[model samples]
Target: MIALLLALGSSLAYGCADFLGGLGARKAHVLRTVLVAAPASLAVELLLWPVLGASFSPSAAGWGVASGAASAAAFALLYQTLAIGPMNVLSPVAALVSAVLPVTVGLLQGEHLGTAGLLGLPLALVAVVLVSAGHGAGGARPSRTALLLAFGAGAAIALQLVFLHQTPPGSGVAPLIVGRAVSSAVTLTAAALLRRRLGPEKPVYAVSAAAGVLDSVANLLFLLAVRSGDLTVVAVITALYPAGTVLLARGVLAERIHRGQVVGLGTAAVAVSLLALT
Candidate 1:
């Protein structure tokens, strides 16, 4: 139950972060937005290090670096895919793949689920897809390139979570700190390389920074949740983040919530209840 709550918190944080990040990206280049966000994320992890305590064991460091690289890849690929999107299809495809990969890995690693969990997991996956379904007027279908990038992004996201889960329990928040550092460096490097292409539009610094903070919080929560819960359950629950994003878009942006998303929100609630009962 505790793990379920933590995972849900992670989902909420992730959703909010994505919303803010998207807003920031609209004002500036994606890489420019990331320039502000990545360092802010690293700063949050650094602050947490003192409170949470950390041990930079070699295993932790290695896994942290791996997760960091995966995170950078995920960020870049996902943004590019969205830029080239038929978003309604690509978003759900990425979300579903991210959830499915982690769940599969968890099961392969010997995690077992109760019957309720088994049922809930599939429902949760479906909910992720539904919640991510965009209500935008029809656009051109995504190119094959966009589809491939979406798949790559999803796989990278899955790897990030899986790698984080591989860290030793005693490592504290060291892995996160290390991962954030690496990711920050990668983001900066990419920004530098693309500076010429980045337009003159000023970034929404405050929004981007807030997004970073929330993203850090989300990662911290996910790390804690996975340490205490079955990875399969935690991953599926976290993947339901799109529901939170949809709700925020409705409440904050006054965007219309589509019928599928409304149904998805209900399905997600039921799925969570079933998982909690296990």
Candidate 2:
């Protein structure tokens, strides 16, 4: 029960961080966001290093780097998708892919679901879809490229989850650090390729940095949760992050929530309850 609660809290914190980081990326350069955010995240992880009491392992480090790179791409593509596509189209697709991929992998590895887990799956899927539904007001409908990128982001996010799940407990923070390092490299390369300067935008950087810290902490907690419990349940609960992101957007950006989102949120709560029962 405690592990489940920690996983849920991590999910919400991650969602909030990602939401703010997404906004920061929109207001500033993507590369700049990564550059500033990665270090901030690293700092937080390092601060918590003592409590982690992790022992270093080369394999775990490798997994972290891989996880980091995938996540960076996921973030970049997701941000690009949201910048141009309708929220209804991109957000849910990406979120669903992220949730499904890890759960699928866990299932393939012989992770059997209890009855409650089975009930949670469809509800979780619905929640992702609803949370992603945009207010039917202003905004251009999704473009072909934007749609493609959204799915692409989903794939990358899925890869991130799988890689994180691969890391064993007590492998140290090296995995997380490696992931950040790889992500930093990937984002920096993307920035350079786009001929965009890494700007000194303090306000945007500050927001991104704070988000990075939360994100890093969430990653650590999630890894711990997965190590301590069933991967399927942990992944499902953590992937409910879209709920947090949607709630934050509705509150801060005055983004109108469609009825779908409301339904999604309600369904997600039920799914969480089911997972808790397990």
| Top TM-score prediction, candidate number | 1
TM-score of 2: 0.90
**Alpha carbon lDDT of each predicted model:** 0.91, 0.80
Q: What is the lDDT of residue 227 in candidate 1?
A: 94
Provide TM-scores for the models: 0.97, 0.90
**Candidate 2: clashing residue pairs, number:** 1
Clashes per model (N, Cα, C within 3 A): 0, 1
Per-residue lDDT over 68-99 for candidate 2, one digit per residue giving the tens place of the 0 to 100 score: 88998888788787777676677878888788
Worst 10 residues of 2 by lDDT: 194-203
TM value for model 1: 0.97
Q: When superposed on Cα atoms, how far off is each prediction in RMSD?
A: 1.1, 2.4
